[model samples]
Target: MGTGWLPWSAASLASGAVLLVLAALTLPPTSEVGQVVGTVRREDAAWLMASAAFFLASVALTMGLPAILTLIPAKQQVVGLVGVWIWSIGTIGTSALAAFLILFRATVRVIDISPTDVEQLGQDPVMTLSLLFVFGAFYLGELVVALVLLLASRLPRWIPALLLVHIAAAPVNHLLPEQLQGVQAVVLGGGLMALAVRSTEAWAALRAPATR
Candidate 1:
């Protein structure tokens, strides 16, 4: 790839990495996992809004990749968590890593909300709708990418079939409520991160195959 494509992907992935960490920080505490109990709703809104803001920014960054990486004129390159091994590990590999971290958090964030709290959330129309729309939608994007990665014939075989299974679950997740949603989020998120770590390393080995 050209110098420009390399930097853009790296920067976008870096920003994405920070967003994931910040997203984690914005997550509701374990104590409030399923409970409506909290110091104040105002604080929660602020955090969610902040995360949303970063999420929007992340989206923009992601969009810029295709153009910036003009060096590689490939369209629909594998964006897999594990499937990136098909391409030598590099910025492409890191993109897979960042993708996983982002998705991982989306899935697990809901476990912190309790069943009773979810019911209470239902009574509060604004929070209920917002909760359903925001979290569910956000997690859906994660699954979308995972699906994109898994199905692309360009993707490596290292990615297990399970990756596709979990990714396909995103839309189905919407059929259920928040309590179950959170569990689904964690499962998908964990899968993404795992794929990132291992794929990147394998890519590295391939790049320097002579060393091995």
Candidate 2:
């Protein structure tokens, strides 16, 4: 297919990154299972729901990122293909996680959970698996994408560097003080926006000679 969607996809990806940042800002912190349950109970439902909704929207909007990056001219085509496949896994995992969060929020209001429920929540296979995705697939995919960009793509050096920084900061974001939890999201969003601008310029450059 032609790259007519390149600019549009890039724009959507940037918008999704911004929304992901908002989701991170609004999501309640969790130190313990009990605390998480408490947050679900005590935090404003709207806020909790918004976090999930934004996350879902973000993932949905940016699902084409792997494709976009793969289309960029690269020194190593095989490496770019590998990166795309790896990031695709991460996309799937993140999408599942987002869906889980949305379902959790949707059901929480109707279901009554006692202390017993909280204890079981940790052991529940669905929840455990979802949490596992955070540690492994979700971040790993982005890490590989950054590496692919750094090693393969002809884009400016800063693009991959910023992505690396964002990936490094994301997992640790919750450990930061409440005031600074959104920093990773901002970095990621900025990087994605930069990528979008670069893509737009590259598209124009490619079409410039054709227009002559």
Candidate 3:
């Protein structure tokens, strides 16, 4: 099979990493949620725009994963495709929910909605459903991808190992200090970049003419 897809896949994966890093850096800290809301209410669009951009970047990152999986061997392609479909659904759901939240917040700010109303919106059924789909589907999707990669043996052992480790560390990541939480994004980005580099090298080798 031609290796031409590898470079494009690597580039998409690398770009996803970059976008994830940007999302992390731009995202407002949960600890400062009140302050962020206040700032957004005061006609400061920075945080709101940043949040929107970050969520959108996450969508892009999610999309890139499936694209890269296309490089998997034919026999294992079914597994990769299944994982990709699951993840893509979660990605789309999460991104849409996030985008909706951002818009709702902006609307509240502009309309000067009451605290009670805002609180109700926080507990809105749609919001709950969105959160459920986002976290539940997203995590499950990630697990599927990780498991498929581990089983397929398409890439180096270390690549899938790193992915599994990253997934396993999710609980511990939440325990990290607010300021330190973003570090996970950096770590993830580094892992993806490493995968990209490895893919590039392997693709080149595959394309090289056979030695006598």
Candidate 4:
């Protein structure tokens, strides 16, 4: 890519990273169905809605990340391509879930849905199957992308290491106390931002000799 577009790409990545962290921060704590409904109704609607919005925006901005990051990989171009495809599928799954969350909140606000009904809906076999697919695809895709970056990209090793750590910790974070739930998102965000900064610096260094 040209120098002109480099800055824009980096900025988009950094912004998306920040939004990811913010989305995680705004997410509600998981609890009993009745408590979850009460939480969503009373104090969590705005937060949950805001979280969904941030997640959507983050996903939109980061959609190109796999392509951009893999552009200059040192080797295994085909592997990078495979990683991109997987990442794209995962992104689509995540986007669907986020959209569903918005609709879910809207439904709760407009209708007097019972907690038992909500609980039953959660137990639907179809929904359970879909959740399994979504979570599996998302985590697997992330791991593949991180591995591509680590094995092929020329960036510092620490960047991809951070991402690997983030991916490993994400599920475990959910098991932690509520206060610690978003830590993995923050770590992932930091890694993305670091990658952006390093890329910009490398591009600038390459241009410096030519400009001189």
Best by TM-score: 4
Instruction: Give me the candidate number with maximum lDDT.
Output: 4
State TM-scores per candidate: 0.39, 0.81, 0.76, 0.83
lDDT of 4 at 75: 69
lDDT of 1 by residue, 1-212 (tens): 32334334444544544444454445453443344334224255644544564554355335333322221114544343222322122223333334543443453364564467555644888755644554444444444444564555433543434445555675676566544544543453344344444444434544565666
Question: Each candidate's lDDT (Cα)?
Answer: 0.43, 0.67, 0.67, 0.70
* lDDT for residue 121 in candidate 3, whole number 0-100: 66
The parts of candidate 4 lying over 4 Å away from their true place are 1-4, 48-52, 64-72
User: Clash pairs of candidate 2?
Assistant: none
Model 4 lDDT, residue 148, Cα = 75
Cα lDDT of model 2 by residue, 59-123, tens digit: 65446574456345656666666665666566556656667666666566678766567778779
Cα lDDT tens digits, model 4, 101-210, are 77777788889888897899899999989977876766676677678777764767888898899878865776788888778888888887886787677668778999
| Model 4 pairs in collision | none
lDDT by residue (1-212, candidate 3, tens digit) is 66566687677768867876776666665653234355456544545655665566566666466554644667878877887777667666656755775886668667866656656666789877868777677667767776777777777777666666766777887677888887767776776777677667766776676643
lDDT of candidate model 4 versus the reference? 0.70
